[model samples]
Target: MQRYFVAPAQISGHTAVLEGDDARHLAQVMRARPGDKFIVCDGSGREALAKVVTVDKDIVRAEIVEERFAESEMAWRVTVAQSLPKGDKLETVIQKGTEAGAAVFLPFLSQRTVVQYDERKEAKRVERWRRIAKEAAEQSHRGVVPEVMAVSSWKSLIGRFAEYDLVLLCYEEEGRAGNGLRRVLTEFAAKQAEGGKPRILIVVGPEGGFDEREAEAAAAAGAKPIGLGKRILRTETAALYALACIAYASGELGGD
Candidate 1:
């Protein structure tokens, strides 16, 4: 069934009103009408089975049938702190990362980052990224859409380290040294099993990867420098690799 995410206010007393693009998609693209069944999420992790009652040009009203328990989300909340790569690579990361259960996408500037930051266009860019995340979340059957954060500087990114239970810095140097990601994730999994949900931050550098000084600074700030593997991965690939490993370790991938 198709899924639509709406604001909390859009749902009231067993009724859901999908407006804007979602409404158009349902009415025109899906050719939805009265009695059409679909899933509705409130963007706060709450989802319900809803049956369409009305379809208009810019609105689609539905009655909530029953609340649904979404097991699609990962038990561990993983945030991808990706350095801004050149071109449209960040879009790919946000789209695929959301499907893979990433909770948030944070783009930051690193020492070797080549893309120039344009304050004038930042809002538009961020908005586009968020849209990509929402669409991907809906398609992936996620109860909540992943947030796409505004770009931050390297210093700003490191300062937020305390916000996460575990911060994995994807450094190629560590990969060459044989410090693998699996061991760190295993430790994190054990901690999660003890009690309480833990938040993880996976930091990947720009196309050039992180400079030695940046890696050292991150490690000093409590971020664990871990390697994806012996083979080097592009900056965009690192976060996805780490997220997959995390999902597997947290049993989201059917692991014990």
Candidate 2:
């Protein structure tokens, strides 16, 4: 079934009214008609099995047939704090990161970042990335669209690191023995086995990667510097790889 996201205000009782771009997509693009059924998520983790009641130019109305909690969200909350890379690599990061079950995407500017974004450009870039996330969420059958935060500096990100229960920093300088990501995941999994939710923050650097001072600063802020593996990957690749590893480690993927 086709999935659409609607705002909470538009949903009242067992009826939902979709407006703006979504309405256009349903009425004109998809040519949806009355009696057709689709899934509608309220972005608050509630999904309704809706049957189209009316299809108008400016509004699309659907009656909820059934409502249930969205199962597409991961049990663990994972946020990716990625330093801006050159070219359009950030778009790929946004798409794959959402599929890998990231709860939020944070784009940061690090010291070694070659691409620069001023205030105006930063706003536009963030909007574009957020759209990428939304499309990815829909494609991946996600319950809620992952949030893409406004671009920030590395300094500011580190300062806010205290909010997460676990923060993993993929630094190339770190070797496999003490700082490998797999080892960290193993240890983290062993630490707990029950109801409490895990909140994680994964940090990935730019194309040029981070300098020594920045790495040290992140370490001081309680982020564990972990190695991705023997082979080095691009900035965008690294973030996606880390997110995949996280999902697997968190048991989001099936296991015996």
Q: lDDT: which candidate is best? A: 1
lDDT of 1 at 131: 94
Task: State the local distance difference test value for candidate 1.
Answer: 0.91
List candidate 1 segments past 4 Å from native: none
Tens digits of per-residue lDDT for model 1 on 1-256? 9998899999898899999899999999999989999999988888999999999999999999999767788888999999999999999999999999999999998999999899999999999999999999999999899999999989999999999999999988898999999998887777665546799999999988899999999999999999899898987788888888988898777746
Instruction: Count clashing residue pairs per candidate.
Output: 0, 0
* lDDT assessment of candidate 2: 0.87
Model 1 TM = 0.97
Model 2 alpha-carbon miss at residue 123, Å: 2.0
In model 2, the worst 10-residue window by lDDT is 174-183
Error in Å for residue 22 of model 1 = 0.8
Residue 132 of candidate 2: its Cα lDDT? Answer: 88
Q: Which stretches of candidate 2 lie over 4 Å from their true place?
A: 175-178
Flag clash pairs in model 1: none
Error of 2 at 125 (Å): 1.9
